[model samples]
Target: MYKNINIFTDGSCISNPGPGGYAAILQYYQYEKIFSQGFFYTTNNRMELMAAIIALESLKENCNIIITTDSKYLKEGITKWIINWQHSKWLCSNKKPVKNIDLWKRLNITLTNHNIHWIWVKGHTGHIYNEKCDKLARYAATNPTYNDIGYI
Candidate 1:
């Protein structure tokens, strides 16, 4: 039997290259774990990716996970687009180096440790956990600055 985990993640940014934040909610059995972080300088995409990465990295052992995100870039990029990027040495179709290669690499490594099913949900809706994640992310983004992780 496999232990199933449900996760919801969100990201927020005041400006494209300004303060940003990410949040992740993990639900397993009857327990829930919440993770949120703020970045002094970051983008929504990076935060979105960070949300998922943080959730996966928090795990101590292999499990089956359902990861939900509001960003299609987060879902489709990891599941659909990354294969080609990996084959092309992290290059996009135009052969430009893929952005956020570091985070993507970290995510890829974390992914190898578990079985993940990606799902995309509409943002700003009334979904309980999704809304909670969004609130946490927005709060982190608008709040005080934190140590920058130097996302590229």
Candidate 2:
């Protein structure tokens, strides 16, 4: 039987394209693992996608996962738009290349290994794990330690 995992994620940016960070909390039964990282230059959406991607990639084996996030962009893009994007060779409705395609591609690849269900929560709405992820992401954003290679 596959282990069931729950992941909560959030991201923050000091500015639209400034210091940013992403955080993910992975829970299995009563055990929890938290991961967060700051980047010197990035966008909030990128950070949001990174949080989910990193969390999925961290799993050691195939498992059933339910990912919770506050970003509609992340949830919608992955669940609703990615199929169209892939069919159009990564172009959006405007015929423009998709933003953060690098991260999107990475996320798509990571997703192939597991069964995932996505849940969306409103930000800062007092949800326990969401609140914790927000605080962790905000703290990491203020103390960036690495470069966002895709952004800079």
Candidate 3:
């Protein structure tokens, strides 16, 4: 038997280099789980990348994971561009530095063990799981008490 799953992820930052949060929701069969966290200082892109990395890391092994995200940068990086980026030592088209190289590296390592299908979705379009993740991430970034409530 195989377990097919869909995961939605997003991240929020109050300001660039400010408070940040990341969230991911995983759905498998009849079970679902939400993971979220807050950081004292970060950026939205970082959170977006982190959510994807965290979700992939949570997978046990060899699972089919369809990762839905709103960030085009993330979807493109993980699904289309990471291979070339890795080959080029993480340089951009202009041969300039790649932003968030650390997170990209982490995401690459975490994703190596799973079969992940990256999907891009429009943000704030009322997708249930995606909305949930966004809400969690925003709340985490704003509310100190709620920071990193469920994510380990």
Candidate 4:
């Protein structure tokens, strides 16, 4: 039997607002691949969002994807409570503006074109793909020489 496509993504930054990177890995039975990008100046949240977006974008149109990430932001925003925010024009509970609205909007649009299942996994528990994603993200953060791939 053919298994479902599985993807895991992660992002890391040296500081809350510092050099950052995002990584994503996709697997389907016998096939697997990884994608990652880094930025010289960014936040962990941005990278996290980027990782998910990148992973989803890598899939063929309309293909169902089961995406796993450690980010409550991605899981909750996409699965739990994004509609309310969208209806409210991207404002938060305090009526304050949401951060990274651009990326959020892009991710939302990308998701609409594909069947995606957002999943949450505990971080740093020795899960092979999860750990690999973390390593890829950290490596990109540490290596600032890499060019930035902004908001794609």
Candidate 5:
């Protein structure tokens, strides 16, 4: 039987490509786990992808998961654009290389281990989990601890 998990994630960047952070809250019934990490340099989009990727990667076994995020880039990319991008050898419609390919690949591999549903919520909209994640992410971005190797 698959364990059911709900995840809330958010990412923040001090500037477009400056200090960044990602946060994820995982809830399994009455138990919850929070994860957050800061990177010295990264884009907001990369941080967003990292939030979801880290959350999914934390699971120890195949399970049913619902991932909620405030990033349309992440939600639409995974749910709507990934297949085509993969089929096209990771090229975007404009024939440019896809950005954040490393994180995207990580997310794809992690995804194969479970059944997942992606959800998108507007940021700063008073959604409880979303707001908490946003606060965590913002705090992390301002207090970065590591460099984002992929962004360097």
Candidate 6:
């Protein structure tokens, strides 16, 4: 039988391109693991993508994973839009390059190793794990300790 893993992720930014952070909660059975980090300067969308990437990368082996996020952008991009984007060599409908291509590429790679089901949850809608992740991301955004290498 395959293992089932539940993951909740969230991201926050102080401003549109200000201090930002991402958080992930991985739950397997009764044990839970958390991952979170902050960047000195970044956008909320980048953080949202990072949260999913970090959570998937943390898995040591292939498993059935249900990743829950509050970002529709994150969910739709990975589950749907990436296909078209990849077919176009990472170009958008406007024939422009996609933003956060680096993170998207990384997440795409990490996904190959597992069975992932993406889920979107409404933010601040009384979801316990989602709320915790939101808090973690907000706290990290307010107190970043690292530079966002991907930020230009």
For all predicted structures, in order, the TM-scores are: 0.95, 0.97, 0.88, 0.90, 0.97, 0.97
* CA displacement after TM-score superposition, residue 133 of candidate 5 (Å): 0.3
Task: Name model 2 segments beyond 4 Å from true.
Answer: none
| Model 2 global lDDT (CA atoms, 0 to 1) | 0.94
Q: lDDT per model, in order?
A: 0.91, 0.94, 0.82, 0.84, 0.92, 0.92
Deviation in Å, model 4, residue 61 alpha carbon: 2.3
Candidate 6 regions with alpha-carbon error over 4 angstroms: none
Candidate 2 per-residue lDDT, tens place, 11-112, comes to 999978899999999999999999999988899999899999999999999999999999999999999999999999999999999999999999999988
Better candidate by TM-score, 3 or 6: 6
lDDT tens per residue, model 3, 103-141: 888888887656778888899999887889999999877
lDDT of 6 by residue, 22-135 (tens): 999999999999999999999999999989889888888888999999999999999999999999999999999999999999989998857888889999999999999999
TM-score of 2: 0.97
Ranking by lDDT: 2, 5, 6, 1, 4, 3
Report the error of model 1 at residue 44, Å: 0.2
Candidate 4 residue-wise lDDT at 56: 78
Quality of model 6 by C-alpha lDDT? 0.92
Q: Residue by residue across 1-152, what tens digits does model 5's lDDT show?
A: 99999999999999878999999999999999999999898889988999998999889999999999999999999998999999999999999988888888999999986999988999998999999999999999999998644743
Per-model C-alpha RMSD: 1.1, 0.9, 3.9, 2.6, 0.9, 1.0
Choose the strongest candidate by lDDT.
2
lDDT of 1: 0.91
Error of 6 at 135 (Å): 0.3
Can you write out model 4's per-residue Cα lDDT over 75-129, one digit (the tens) per residue?
8887866788898899988998778888888889887756677788899998888
